[model samples]
Target: MTAVSIEKKVNGTPVASPELGEGRDHPDEEQHTPQPTPAAPSRREEKRLDKSTDRADARLDKAQEREEARRDADHKRETKEKERQAKADRKAQQRADKDKARAKRRKERRTAWTSLQTRLTHHMPMWGLPVVLVSLAVGATGQAGAASAAGMGWASAGVPVLTEGMTLTLAGLTGQAIEQRRPYAWLMRATWITAAGAATINALGHYIEGKAGDPQEALYRAAMYGVASMLGLVLWWVVMRSKRAAISGKTADEVARWKRLGRRHPLLMRRARRVADNTGKSMADAYATVWERANGARPGEPSIREIRASRRAAYRRRLAQSWDGRRGLRKQSERAAAVVPVPQADTVGTPESAGSAGVRTPVQAPALPVALLVPGGQGGWVEHPVPVLPMATPKRVRTGSDQSATARFPQGKDAVSKRVRKSVHDDRLNTVRALVESEAARGCDLRKHPSNRAVARAAGCRPGTARELLATVLAERGITR
Candidate 1:
């Protein structure tokens, strides 16, 4: 059994047992004491720590919230600012647009004002007025000088009526020169009229004095004065013109105006298209003429009006299909028949004559009734049987020496010659041409017409060639479009 001992020591707790080796040095002491352990903290302490932690957390949250709020506020402010900026920009654009419109209006107004100013300021003289005034002045002045010179003679002779007239003429002439501002050229002409007037006045004054005063001597002196006055007037005119030439630069107001008025009048320009068109020619030719005149004046011959009228008449007649025209054509066709070969009679004894032999008059059938003569009988009925003349086989004459050529021509006197054959071909072509022309006149497109090839074949040419030839012939005659 294990012993349980208790021991106590100063400043030491009781030891219940001593170890074997350590027992000699110190008595054993035994103590049973449980260590004191701290209990769980109070609610208050836990609450304090929790509160501290919570406060830190809260501070962080508050900082985060503040930061986020600030950011949000900043974002809102930025958005508002952007909107405000947009509004401001719109307003600015509106203002700018208004300014632009105002500027345009202002420019228009300025241009209008400038135009008005130009019109308002523009001015020119009345029609030819200044010229007439100058003419009168020059005429009167020259007349006065002549009168003054002749007056001396009259004064010496003492004719009271004449003396007063000479003085009056001189005074009126001097007053006219200073008052008028007419053209110088007119003034020059005025000088001539004035000189003539002065000479006449002087002559009258002297004549009157010669009759009233010392009859014989006065009469001689009067004649001398009249001659002197005329001479003086002529000299005065020469002097004025020489002086005008010597004067340089443009004449004062009068001289400058005279220069302007001196220009040759320009010929009136007007459109000639109406007259040109009225001229008888193709419209294309007329238009070409107009273009020529408009560009350079390498003028072509003007279309003849008479020729046009004639062509128009022909056109009208053709369009109307006049009976006279048809009759004339029939006559032409009959005339053309002269070239066609006549089929000779095949009778054993009938004589072959140019007029007597024809297919239309059948020699074999004598006096057949007109009803029996008709082809494809009336009411589509069969015609009465009558012996009709057979087409005479063309007789060939052996004009050639060759045996081979003799085979084609029989021993007939009326055998066709090469020349005759050519003539017949020409006649057939002419007939075909006439037919083509009639069709063309009916407004057919000859280019595509089926008859055109046949006509061309008869014409011994291509279709286009035939058309070209027809066009040229018609155009030359000016009969068809």
Candidate 2:
């Protein structure tokens, strides 16, 4: 053990203590150093840290949610905008399609109206305009007079004239606009009659009613009507001449239209062509006449072919009737002949007619001797036993015109008939040849008209003569038939 010292200070003086020799240092001792104490966290700091962690997490969550909502809104807005745009486009397309259909119908009606007007203008009578105007004027004037007599409120002297004049003028203007330049002959006559009747009625009204309001005016109106009528006549004549010239000088389009119409109306065209051929008229004139007939004008004259066909039809009908009558008469005659008895010749009964009743009995001819006596003996000489005549012997005739036969006794008659026929044929050949030659020289096409009947008609010869002449001509031409 080691000794240790102790010291003490009391008040201000130093002092030593005896008991201070306490235990001293040991060899193995430990020393301890003083350390400061750690402090605990505050409540505010802990709360602030918790609040900051929570705020950071909450902010991240809020940002993610906002992004999701923005994406959703953008997608929804895009879908809604596409749907609205599609709806607007569909509505606009429907509106555009409806406007195109109404424009096509208006064009078709205008063309038809023009064609009708042209047709009416061409067909109506021209002279009827003035005549109808005059009659209307007279009728209106009479109506006004009647109204005046009845004490109507509309009755005025000027009213009648104004109405009459306006109506007549309108009618005249309509006639002119319609291009009426000429009337048919019958229509002209009717119009003239109507005009005369109107004039008579007007004169009678003026004279009887003691209303000769203005004679000069009446004369002037009459002159105006007369002048209009005369002018219409002149204009109609000029228009007719011009139309005739136009028809004669047909345009290409007119000619083509006519051709198309002719093809459609083939029968009418054929008739027109026939008329043109027979009457020596121009084909255009005949075609125009036929077209007019088809358009409701007077019918054209019958063609030569039509006349001939009618005549032929009538002749055939008469011939058929006569033929039927003749056939009936013949049948009647046959029946009468069958009903009546016929006389029979009486003779010896033959083997064929032995059993049948009312059959004619056939007579047997006697056989002649094969030998004949010549005039070697006198006429009064008796029949002597003559030798049998040879079959090859020829017969001789005594008369000048009698024919001689070179055949045997049995065939002599046939030979003589043939010789006589040959002589007659030879005599007819000369006259037939002359007639045929004359027909040939007259430009007859003998080959096409090689018929004997045709030759007979043309050559004024018999059919047999014509046939003989044809044979001769054919032989001359080295054309044997």
- RMSD of every prediction: 33.7, 33.3
Candidate 1 regions with alpha-carbon error over 4 angstroms: 1-51, 123-481
Score each candidate by Cα lDDT.
0.49, 0.52
Tens digits of per-residue lDDT for model 2 on 285-397?
67665554343222354433444468579766544432311234454334333332223445577445556787774644322232234455556534433222112222255
lDDT of 1 at 180: 41
What lDDT would candidate 1 get against the real structure? 0.49
* Candidate 2 displacement at residue 377 in angstroms: 99
Clashing pairs in 2: none
How accurate locally is residue 248 in candidate 2, as Cα lDDT from 0 to 100? 47
Candidate 2: count of backbone clashes, pairs at least 3 residues apart or interchain = 0
